[model samples]
Structure formats: structure tokens, C-alpha cells
Target: MFEKVLIANRGEIALRIHRACREMGIHTVAVHSTADADAMHVRLADESVCIGPPSARDSYLNIPAILSAATITGADAIHPGIGFMAENAQFAEMVEEHGFTFIGPTPEHIRIMGDKVTAKRTVQSLGMPCVPGSDGPLDTVEDALATAKRIGYPVLIKAAAGGGGKGMKVALGPEQLREAYQLARGEARGAFGNDQVYMEKYLAKPRHIEIQVLADTHGNAVHFGERDCSVQRRHQKVVEEGPSPALNAEQRAHIGGIAANVVRELGYRGVGTIEFLFEDGQFYFIEMNTRLQVEHTVTEMITGIDLVREQIRVAAGAPLGYGQDAIRFQGHSIECRINAEHPDTFMPSPGRIDGYHAPGGLGVRVDSALYDGYRIPPHYDSLIAKLVVHGASRNECLMRLRRALEEFVIGGVETSLPLHRRIISEPDFINGSYDIHWLEHLLGLKG
Candidate 1:
């Protein structure tokens, strides 16, 4: 067992990992940027090192600094918590080469799944259903037109790297395809430093469902069920839930098997998610996130499993604690991302929090990186906190969530709490028949 593990990220996830390490009796070395000097993770960890300045580029994302911290602290492993160097393949390889456990999948798995094009192809080879699209990178307008004709309209042109809805465009015709292709390519190149763009048949009113899969080096794999991430704005998921209200028992079982099959076939390890777009009763693979997702808490809330701890155990070559048949899922879980942004205008709102009181009592969990007087840093993600609630049933969960949101008293900066309140009250959302455009449609911002 590793005596000490270096954490290569910050904020709520970092603290979450620290708590898990404390339980496992593993010492933690936290790396923080200058701006995060007073961060909770720093104070909680066994040891901490200031990597660099306020900017993430000079600090949290600095490879050498993080590696140096791990070496100096005598950490046997490095755990990248959802950001910074989490999915960087080169960094993963470097850590292993330096005799430190990466605490995730192999570098080959990360590299293959990091690129959208390669990931789609690999999943397709594993016999997973994917949305019809281009075969590979399209260089010319002519190349795009040929692919679009085969794919049919309307199609989505997306960057072959990165998510969060950046470098993506939807086109309905040849002229629009040619025009949008260059723009998407340029955006992809600028955003991810890779101009590789691919195509997919765009689904209208599709539900975003993802299955959580965990695999061990011993070839044991099982799924924890699915999360409904249909509540999104600007292509980024704002809210998520486990045991999707829309899924039937049979459908859930089918999808869960598909996710486990992919992991076993790919020789992947650790916790990963297989995201899919469901339209009309058909499921199409979107992409696989090779790291723990922001919505992982919802799954944990439903399944009673600590995914982060499981990742560490997997890296240690431990066999899965539970077998496929032993894994049971119950109840319904929901998570609302409380970002420091205006509910309507969606602009960043960063400042010191005034009154910071979270809802408690029963079935409510709030994961946040804030406290009284903790400055909401303007340099990073605007997400101030996460509100998760679970219930005996979906309806009961919604009722509890609505009440919990009412009790949360966050002051100083604007938040998405009101937005969450509005969503739970809406008839469409409550019906669980919502699609990707549900949020924008509810807000009257159809783009």
C-alpha cells in the first residue's frame, strides 16, 4: 500500500479525496496554486506544497512543480482529481516512468479515449452503437459535404478533443456545413490545439444519459447505473441525477451491460463513464470520460459507493470489492451544480461569500469549496458548490430537493440556486421527458 499519495488538483474534489485518504490511513500531499493558499484541501491534507502563482497555467497545471512536490513528499502515487493534469496522457506516463503510480488507467487508455475520433472508432469496434457521422478528420469543404451526405442532415460538427460544448456547430445543409466546418475546425485548433473535427447525426430532443463503469486490473468490471444529465445550458450539464426518471428496469440493465462490456473489451481500468444520447428508444454512444465526472456524487448517493476510494483501490491492484451480482442500486439521486453565475444572464459572479449556510437534515449533500470569507476565485471554474439529494423514489427526491433548495441561504454573490428551484417546479422537468434543449427552451433561449 502507498504510504503517501500526492493530490494533483484542488477545490471540492481535492477535499473529497482527502477525506477518503484519511479513512484509508493514507497520507496525502496537496498541491495548490498561490491563489489557493487558504483553500480547505491545503489545510486538510497531511502536507501541502505551493506549486506556482494565481494563474492555473503557472501552478495547478504545472507538470514539473506537481512532480517535484510528489517526489519531495515521497508520495508513492499521484491522484489527479477531475482537473488540472487528470487526463493528460503524457503526465500519466511521466508519473509511471518516475516510479509513481498514476492511480488511473494506463497511458494508452487515456490517449485513446482522450481523442474523440479515436474513442468513437474504438467503441464502435467494441460493438457499441454510436451516432452516425464522419469516418475521420475532414480537411476540405468537399470532404465535409461527402460525409454529411452520407450522415444526412441535421448533423453536429464537434471537436475531436475536449468537451464542455466548445468547438461545436450544427449544420443543416451543404452550404451551412462548409461554412460551419471551418469555424469549428479553427475553434477546435484554438481551444484544444488540435483542429481534428468529426461529424455526428444531431438528435432532436435527446436525453443525455451516462453509465458509470469501474474496472480492475484483474478484469472485473461492473456498472453503477446511469445519470440523467439532460438539464444543461450551453452544452455543459448544470444538473444531474442517478437512476434516471425516464429509464425502465430493462433499459437500465441493458445500458449498464453495454458500459461494462466496453471497459472489459478495451482493457481499461479505474472509474470511467460511457456517455450516450438517447432518442426515441435508441442509444448512441457519445464519448467516454476517462476520469471521475463532476456528477459522480449523484451515483455515489444512489449506490452507496465511494468512487474515488474505489479508484485508489483499483490502482493498488485490488480486486473489485463487490461482484456484478452483488452490486445493487436503489432510490433516486439528484445533483445541482451551484455556480457563481447569474441565473438569467449566465455571467460569472466571483466574490467573498457573505452568509454561507447549506441545507441539511436528511438525504441532502452539499459538496463545495467555499466557507465564510473564502474568496470565490475569478481565475477558475465559477462553480461554488454542488447540492445533492436522494429520495426513496424520484417524486420524493424532487420534493425533498425543492425543499432543500429553499433552505440553502447563500449570500454575497449570485448563484444558480434559483435556477434549480425553477427547474424542479417546471412541469416538463418534473415529467422527466426533458431533452438537451430543455433548459434553454424553458428559459426561451433556443439557439
Candidate 2:
């Protein structure tokens, strides 16, 4: 086991890693910007270092500053708690070159899976089904047009290097292809420094299902199961649950096996997520997240497996302690990402937290870094916490989630709590009949 691990991110996830490290008897080093000197993770870590100013470029995203902190603190490993440099292949390589373990997948896997186009090709070659689209990047408008004609109308133009729903556009037909192409290219270039785009058949109202896989250096890989993350806005996940109500036991086993196989084939280490778009009983590979996901908590709740501990153990050259059959998936778990934003407008709400109290009781867990007097800075994501609940069943889980949300309270800043309450009470949501477009449509009705 590593003597010390440096966490290279901020917010609740940083705290999440800290708690995990503490439980494993590993010392933690928290690297923070000036804006987060008093952040919860900073306060909880065994040691702390100020990286840079408030701006991400000079702070959280600054590679040199983070490496310096880890080196000076004698951190043998660095755990990137999602976002920032979590999926950066270059950053992972840099960490390894500096004689520090990057507690995630290998840099080779990250590089291969970081590009959407390359990821699709690799998965397809590995016998996983992929959406019908261009064989590779569409170098010309004619290539896109031809591919669209073959795949049928309503195709999506997605950036080869895109993420977080950026650098993407949907074209209903040839008339809209040109505009979508140009816009996606510009956005992709500006955001990822790569304008290359690819086309694929866009399924209407497909559910976003992702399988969580864990592999160790000893050549053992297994999957915990799938997470239903269809409840999203602007392509960002909000509400996530496990053992998707949409899939049966057979379907779950099939997809989970495929995800596990992919990890094994790649000789991947640590935790990763293989995302797919499911429609009409068919699963099409979308992309792979080469690092731990925000919804990993839901998977942990159902499996009773500490994913973070497993991640650390694997990085320390340990074999997986359990096999696929030994893993048990019990009950249903749900997580609601609570962000400091206007309930209706969804604008960022960054200010002092006057009154704060997280809900408690059975199966309720609040992963947050908020306190009564802490002021939220506008320099980063507005997400303040994650309220995760588990129950014996999906229905029970939803009910518990509702009660937890009602019990939770935060003052001096608007939160999405009211919106969440309204969502959980909706008939469609209650029945688990919602898809990716469900939340947007619900928001439109309110508008």
C-alpha cells in the first residue's frame, strides 16, 4: 500500500478520496488553490499544499503545481478524483515518469479511449457493438452526408475528442448537416484543440446505461453492474441509479459481461466505466470513461464494495480479492447531484452558505464539503454535494430519496432541491419510464 497519496482535484470527490484513504490507513495530501484553502478536503487531509491562484489553469488544472506538491509531500501515488486531469493521458504519463503511481488506468488505455472515434473503433474491433457511423473521422462534408444517408436521418455529429456534451450537434437531414458540421468543428477545435468529428445514427430517447468495471494488475477483471444515468440535462448526468429498471436479469448479465471483457482485453487496471446507449433491447457502445465516474457511489451502495479502496489496492499491485460470481448486487441505489444553482433557471449560485444541514438516517449518505459559513466560489463547478440513498428495491429507493431530499436543507443560496422534489413526484419518474430526454421535456413544461 502507498504510504501517502496526493489528491489532485477539489470538492466532494476530493473529500471522498480522503475518507477512503483514511480508512485504508494511508496518509493523504490535499492540493488546493488559494480559493480552496479552507475546503473540506484540505481540512481533512494529513497534509496540504497551496498550488496556485483561483483560476483552474493556474490551480486545479496546473500540472506542474500538482506534481510539485506530490513530489514535495513524498506522495508515492496521486489519485485524481475525477475531472481536471482524471482522464488526461498525458498527465498520467507525466505522473508515472516522475516516479509516482497514477491511481487509475494505464496511460495507453487512457490515450486509446480518450478519443471518441478511436474508442469506438477499438471497442468495435474487440467485438462490442457500436453505433453505425463513419468508419473514422469525417474529413469532408460529403463523407458525413454519405454516412448519414446510409445510417438514415437523425444522425449525430460528435467531436472525436468531445466530452460533457460539448462539440456535438444533431442533424435531422442533409439540409442541417452543413451547419451542424461547421458548428461542431469550431466547438471541438476551441474546446479540445481537435476539430475532427464523427457521425453516428442517433437513437431517439435512448437510455444512458454504463457498466462499472474494476481490474487489478494480476489479470483479474469484474463488473459491479450497470447504472441508469438517463436523467440528465445538457448531456450531464443528474440522477443515477443501479440495476436499471429497464433491464432484466439476463440483460444485465449480458451487458455487464461485455463491459468486464473489454476491461480484461485491454489489461486495464483500477476503475473504469464503459458507457452505452440502449434502445429497443440493443446496446451500442458510446464511449469509455478511463477514470472513476461521479455515479460510482451508486454502484458502491448496491455492491457494498469500496471502489476507492479497490482502486488503491490495485495501484499497490494487489489482486482482486473477489471474483465475478462472488460479487453480490443487492437492492437499488440512487444518487442525486445537488448543485448550487437556480432551481428553474439552472444558473450557478455561488455565495455564503448561511444554514446547512444534511439529511441522516438509514441508507442515506451525503457527500459534501459545505458548512454553514463557507462561501462557494464561482471558479469551479457549482455542484455542492451528492445525496445518495439505498433501499431494498427501486420503489423503496425512490421513496427514501424523496424523504432524504425533503429533510435536507441549505440556506443563503438556491439549490436544485425543489426541482428534484418535483421530479421525484412526477408520475413518469415514479414509474421509471423516463429516458434521456425526460428531464429536458419536464423542464420545458415548467417553462
| Candidate 2 collision pairs | none
Tally clashing residue pairs in candidate 1. 0
In order, candidate lDDTs are 0.90, 0.93
Tens digit of per-residue lDDT, candidate 2, span 26-49: 999999999999899999999999
Superposed by TM-score, candidate 2 places the C-alpha of residue 424 at a distance from the truth, in angstroms, of 0.4
Stretches of candidate 2 off by over 4 Å are 445-447
* Per-residue lDDT over 219-242 for candidate 1, one digit per residue giving the tens place of the 0 to 100 score: 889999999999998899999988
For each candidate, give its TM-score against the true structure.
Answer: 0.98, 0.99
After superposition, which runs of candidate 1 have C-alpha atoms over 4 Å from their true positions?
Answer: none
